[model samples]
Target: MELGLEVAEGPAPYTVLAVKGEVDVYTAPRLREKLVELVSQGKHQIIVDLEGVDFLDSTGLGVLVGGLKRLRSNDGDLSLVCTQSRILKVFEITGLTKVFSIYDSVDGATAS
Candidate 1:
């Protein structure tokens, strides 16, 4: 499956990255590059909306961790909008649920 990425403005102090499709090894690089580009543009507080994502592998998780680290290094943060059980399980099993500020909706993440 392919990975679709869209960049948009979020609530104050945040930028939203709407993601669709699968995020596997082949497509992970695209997501990583976009995150890097956003951080380079000083968009450090990011909200990755994974509502449209159907699948996510370890490589995808790594990309997110990398992005989070990058943002934190810049005194910013990376949050996630993901409610799917399968995807949430990935974060949970990886112990990343505690690391990332994940919410059910964009509004939820923005409020935090």
Candidate 2:
């Protein structure tokens, strides 16, 4: 499936990035570029909504980690919005569940 990325301003200091589709090596670059673009544009607090993602690989995880690091270095943070068991499993298996704040919904992510 094709990757889709929709970015929007969150309640206050957050930017919500809604992503759907496969996020393997092939599509991970696009997501990384979007994260870089957002950061460059001064959007520090980012909530990556992965509820629609059907597949994710190591490359995608690396991208998220990189984005989180970048944001944190800027005194900001990166959160994730995801509820799919399959997708959440990747984080759990990789121990990234503890590294990234994973929320069930965009609203929940934005609240924190």
Residue-level lDDT of model 1, residues 68-106, one tens digit each, is 999999999999999999999999999999999999999
> lDDT at 77 for candidate 1?
92
What TM value does model 2 have? 0.98
The positional error of residue 79 in candidate 1, measured at the CA in angstroms, is: 0.2
Candidate 2 clashing pairs, residues 3+ apart or interchain: none
Q: Which 10-residue span in candidate 1 carries the lowest summed lDDT?
A: 1-10
Error of 2 at 37 (Å): 0.3
* lDDT of candidate 2 over 1-112, digit per residue (tens): 7999999998988899999999999999999999999999999999999988999999999999999999999999999998999999999999999999999898988777
Q: Candidate 1 regions off by >4 Å?
A: none
